[model samples]
Target: MKKILLTVFAITFFINAKAQSAEVAITKKENDTGKIYTSVEKAPQFPGGIQSFYHYLAATIVYPVDARTKNRQGRVIITMTIEKDGSLTDIKVVRGVSPSIDQEAVRAMSACPKWIPATQNGLPVRVLYTVPIAFTLGK
Candidate 1:
């Protein structure tokens, strides 16, 4: 019975992992500029840390009035270029929930302070970062 339970748990974990991988299709942008990289040796860090960044977003983000009124809720994925100077540029919506929510996500990201830029071989490089912002209505 112990062996059977362990096998079942392993199978369930594998299946769940596969399902999650299938749900998120990440297409890394391919470019030959030698300036922008999808994956670098060292990735950028948000001000303070990722947790602090989330807290900042939660505190600063204002849900769209139209989206709240329409009862629309989903995750909005935003892609932006973290420049070599720790500045963000080319902000865009990779996968948007709705127009209002999408706009808000972009707004929130745009308002972010500079980040610690990514590095490759001890040199700063522009890198692409994708962030998912979720919008949910209150109870």
Candidate 2:
């Protein structure tokens, strides 16, 4: 059928397109740690350290001044994965208040410094961690 053939063609095209980009490969590697290109000798610390990182980041983020980012605009809830290498990646708005606030959440995330990488079974391995940051304006 035409539909099946088109689907296969689309899949193949996407595959080839991904193979052609260095950024795509890097992003994919960042998502998946199974395929080893080089040894990630530097491992991040555990949840305790990540908690500390969050605490510090919370104090450091500059709340956006836009209408939606304001307290009057409601709350911004963001969920993102903190990778094993202590890198913050895949920031997405799980519960969004507004587009402006969503972008602010992402900006706040990017502003954060590197964290202690995560570990698995005593070895440094990439682990998926979830965090929710709520933006609330003052009283």
Which structure among the candidates has the greatest TM-score?
1
Off by over 4 Å in 1: 1-34
Q: Which stretches of candidate 2 lie over 4 Å from their true place?
A: 1-32, 35-55, 68-75
Please, what is the TM-score per model? Answer: 0.75, 0.54
lDDT per residue, candidate 2, 1-139, as tens digits?
A: 3333233223332100111222223332543455321123333443465445445545555556675244544445554455556677666776676677667767876777766654434554443334455555543
Candidate 2: residue pairs that collide? 44-116, 44-117, 45-116, 45-117
lDDT of each: 0.69, 0.48
lDDT of 1 by residue, 1-139 (tens): 3333233223332100011121232334446544566666677888797656766677667878888788998777788988888889889998899998899889988989999987777888777787777676546
